[model samples]
Target: MAILATEGLTKRFPRVTALDELTVMAGTGVTGLVGANGAGKSTLIKILLGLLPPTSGRARVLDLDAATHGLEIRRLVGYMPEHDCLPPDVSATEFVVHMAQMSGLPRTAARERAADTLRHVGLHEERYRPIGGYSTGMRQRVKLAQALVHDPRLVFLDEPTNGLDPQGRDEMLALIRRIGTEFGISVLVTSHLLGELERVCDHVIVIDAGRLLRSSAIGDFTQASQAIAVEVEDGLEPLVERLGGLGEAVAVQGRLLTVQVPADADPGRTYDAVRDAVCDLGLNLVRLEQRRGHIEDVFKEPVA
Candidate 1:
């Protein structure tokens, strides 16, 4: 099912057109909403969630009209805002339980479910501690716990790793993956970093200047293309010269090398030739893999 969708959706804020004729779709699993800052990613998400009415066009959440069915959608969908909104006075246990009860669960059931949700999000004994004493990662988990406390069917995670460290980011990403695969919750996650989303998202939708740039499965971005990526410890100057002399389309990126092979030509021969050249030169072979385009490649020139 299409968990969320928008068609020519637009939003205007006095002088700025936050979103301009934007369209997007989110299916089951994790769909990545990727764009740089001010690229209209947040505006598009808001329109679909019915938080802001679109200036033009249509949007739907789970087949219901975003304009008319917003109330119903709110019950079925969970939203984890990008910014911090935790109450400093209360503990995670208290906040999540309150959120669950507000979602129509009874007090006892709400508290019970809040405890389970907190644990599922990796918050243990510290959950009972006051929010004022929590670290950034702990606070982020509390936010996530509240989002899931109501047992929502679909979720919108807006930069869940925004302020997290490397370790915290990895932990949050794993949690997001599990929420979709293990818990059966469809998710639309946003990130300004294109490469970061590539690691965790099943599909990616790139947007630029409030317009839809491209939308495709992750495989399309990482498919075996005509370019080959070769890496060695050193002596890339000689390798580039040798490969260029041999009439192979080769280029260097940082410590790695990229050799473009012919479409129908045998990659094995190309690989062997590169291997032999490195061996003959007595250079260390670090790695060799096929070169695939990334989300940033979509922006190398134009998204068109």
Candidate 2:
């Protein structure tokens, strides 16, 4: 079932059009909403959450019309905004319990859920400290904890990894995957980083300039191409020349060489050609593997 959908959805400000005839659908599991800044990602999220109205078209969430059932939808949807909107003075436990209660949980259940959610997000004694004293990663965890405290069926996480370090980003990504797989909550995560989404998302939807660019399963986006990627420890240029001399279509991408396998040619022959070239040059082979597509490849094609 579609968790959320937009049909010819558009939103315009007096000076700018944030969304332009945008239409897309997201189902179960972790679906990634990928686009650059100013790509109308935030606007689309607002419309889906029933926080903002569209200039044209329709949006539905959890089979409820976003325009008409916004209050009920908000009750069942959790949102973790991209920016740091947490209160500086309150402790994580306090803030999260308050949010849970606001989501309509009773005081006892709210406190209990808040504590469990905080622990699930990796907070312990530190959860009692004022949010202002917490690190960026801890603050992000608090945000995530509140979003899950009420146990919503789906979450709209906007750049949850923003301002996180490399390790922190990895941790956050794991947590997101756990939300979808372990907790059984559907996710619609937004990010400008294609690599991050590629790692955790089951599906990806690409948008550019407020228009749909491409939407497909993560496997479809990263399918293996009829090309091999070669890397050598030394004599990179010489290896390229040797492969080209053998009539191979070779392109250099930084330290890696991408050699295309012709439609009629045998893949084993291409592998042999690469192996022989590296051997003749006495260059140390680093990596020789099939090249796969990436979510970033969507930007390489013209918008359809």
Candidate 3:
């Protein structure tokens, strides 16, 4: 049930290769395409949308070959480019309606869908105002509204939270989650931010300079580790000394200490050691919890 896939995809320019033998798949639910700027994320999206031709390899969207069936694929897919492309003088409602009609909706149905989509994105009464007068967040909503207006089966959202404030970013992410869950539309969202993707995506694909790094479910990417995170209010040094004497490995980060759970030892014993160490030093225990992995851990050098 892959909504989009690429096999041995490679795109080369005169001076650099944008994508290099990258193979990946995205199924239903929200999937994140994560990488830094110039990582070929945008280039991959363009190829998938059939907007750019790859130098070699194959790409398919909604089971249609991107090279041969681009028009058919575009009809089923919605794309929101990273950069601003909306007309300044056009009202959101008018713009969305035009886009829906362009997607083959009847004029009357287009208008109705435009209103509904704009409202769903939280545009409200401001949707009738010219795009020129809108804030960055409002402009973003307008772009999102048009993408969803045609009721596309899948959407390629390229940095939908770009230029947004914290609150706006949260709102946009929530909206994306709803599109996949409530509206039943598949989503492929691209971003340089890893944590945001971890929050909303069911699966994530990581790439660097157009090369595939890893692809897996969110849970797999952030599994629990064999380490315990401990924090205390005071007596940190004494607690560290006491834990070391009790045969524990400890790494301190400010107020938190991460103690590793020995491979052959019981985790309960490790927990007990930490508790007894804190109690022996008369330090107020703030937190004692098992450490969990994070998407950022992928970029770190593995512990030997």
RMSD to true structure for each model, in Å: 4.9, 5.0, 5.5
- Candidate 2, residues 1-304, lDDT tens digits: the string is 9999999998999999999998899999999999999898888889988999899999999999999999999999999998989999999999999999999999999999999999999999998889999999999999999889999999999999999998899899999999999999999999998777777899889998888988888876633345789989978999988889999999999999999877566668888999899888899999987653454556776554
Error of 1 at 126 (Å): 0.2
How does each model score on lDDT? 0.85, 0.89, 0.88
TM-score of 1: 0.78
Tens-digit lDDT string for candidate 1 (1-304): 7888889988899999888888788789999998888988788778777888989999999998988888888889888999999989998899999999888889999999999999999999998888999999999999999999999999889989999998898899889999989999988999987666776788999888888888888766633344668888888999888878777878778988988766567667777788888888889888886543455555664554
Best by TM-score: 2
Model 3 clashing residue pairs (backbone): none
- Best to worst by lDDT, what's the order? 2, 3, 1
Q: The CA-based lDDT of model 2 is what?
A: 0.89
Off by over 4 Å in 3: 223-296, 301-304
Cα TM-score of candidate 2: 0.79
Model 2 regions lying over 4 Å from their true place: 223-296, 302-304
Per-residue lDDT value at 150 in model 3: 92
| Range of the 10 consecutive residues with the lowest summed lDDT in candidate 3 | 295-304
By summed lDDT, the worst window of 10 consecutive residues in model 2 runs over 289-298
**Candidate with more favorable, higher lDDT: 1 or 2:** 2
Q: Between the candidate structures 2 and 3, which one is better when assessed by lDDT?
A: 2
